[model samples]
Target: MNDSHSAELLRYAAFTADPAGGNPAGVVLDATGLDAADQLAVAADLGYSETAFLTPAAAGGRAFAVRYFSPRAEVPFCGHATVAAAVALAERIGAGELLFETKAGPVPVLVEAGPDGVLAATLTSVEPHVEPVAAADLTEALAALGWSDGELDPAFPPRVAYAGARHLVLAAATRARLAELSYDFERLAALMTRLDLTTLQLVYRESEHVFHVRDPFPVGGVVEDPATGAAAAALGAYLREVHGVQEAELTLHQGEDLGRPGVLRVELRAGDPRIRVSGTAVPIGPRRG
Candidate 1:
């Protein structure tokens, strides 16, 4: 990569104010000159689960065309990266509203300082939908993850959910079941690839409005995503649809299993099909691979 292109890369940890926590994402504030391959190469080099590349929109005031690239491929949308990019921009341009035109759709983001003086970004996802996972597909997924029907929560039936991207939502019957995450990586990757899934949203409900979650992101070439915004949004939709939770704010605790703990706040509003995910992101210094 060219030195100038490399110079444009900014690193941040999303979903947490602490640099050591959250999911780290690379953000290219100006990627007007970078092509798809260049963006992918940068993401792969950084070894982050995903990166955000932005180009000024044609009608440019506080608007940009954003694309997300994983280490191995381009994803339709990414929550943590979006939050990172938005916070990065807010730090420079001042907090406010920004619009991102993404592959999934137009995503509206709001950035503002929280009561604690930390900047937080909230992205409103495109209309989300939840669908059933075929019995055979669910069976394959269970086999790949080394989970059985008995291990799954009977209340939260297995389903494929979509906010900006698709994820298979599987709720564990117990917190212990969610903690031990040794799985067949290649086998899970194959199943996810066939199912066009981005990650497996493994979760255990700690309370009515609290959950502990983990995302296995083999499709993105990452063993796990420390904090997953997209899946959290999908989970909101799933809760609304299946659990009849019309309106409520839910807190998701993720990345704890990997020791990079972060928080994701999911808001579901009555009469609105879109999900809103909010989190704080902080810039991190350069790291060598």
Candidate 2:
């Protein structure tokens, strides 16, 4: 590892209390001199879905402004990265409110130490909206995913859901169907590129308030995300809009197949269109360099 690689990288697993669970995120506490290319290189080297870069802010509110980068490219916003960044900041400054200016928009995150002294972080995304997926586009996506229309759940129709980033929401009729995730990566990546999609959110509803999800993030150069907070927020919005759930709190379980179990809490209020995702994060370890 070179000197640049030695630049402090904090690892955290977002959306889970255990380090072995949740989505792993690489966080650089001080990204003052790093350029876009350097950031991308670092993320690629880390081999995580996304890495967050923080630079000191001018207003002196939160210590730094944050940026997220996937292995292949820079995303507008990443919820897991946000959670990881917030938790990393909380470790140094104590838990409190953090305001982040992302490519998509401003995101507000609240961090606090739980009763058990574990750091918990909740991020409020930008206002979300649901749109109908074009029939032709759906056909292409289904073809790429090797899923037939019959396997889809009738209750949760296919739609493009956006909460900071766009994701196509698809519900499986059975949990077994959701577990088997074999898809054409190149084909799906091409389709997502054309559709401007971030990930394909595949879900199975266990109950009215409980769901299991898997996210195919081909665009981010990952076959499947172990845990995806952005897609979880989008899924919550889709459920609220289509199912008309009165209560705003919902639970999501993900990454079971990948063996990295994670839990995400989705909160939606009556008047608030923005979705809130809450989770606990634990540091993975010190940076390699």
Candidate 2 per-residue lDDT over residues 178-205, each given as its tens digit: 9999999999999999988999999999
**lDDT of predicted model 1:** 0.94
**Global lDDT of each candidate:** 0.94, 0.90
Q: How far is candidate 1 from the true structure (C-alpha RMSD, Å)?
A: 1.6
- Model 2's alpha-carbon lDDT is 0.90
Clashes of 1: 0
Runs with alpha carbons beyond 4 Å of true place in candidate 1: 1-7, 287-289
What local lDDT score does residue 144 receive in model 2, on the 0 to 100 scale? 92
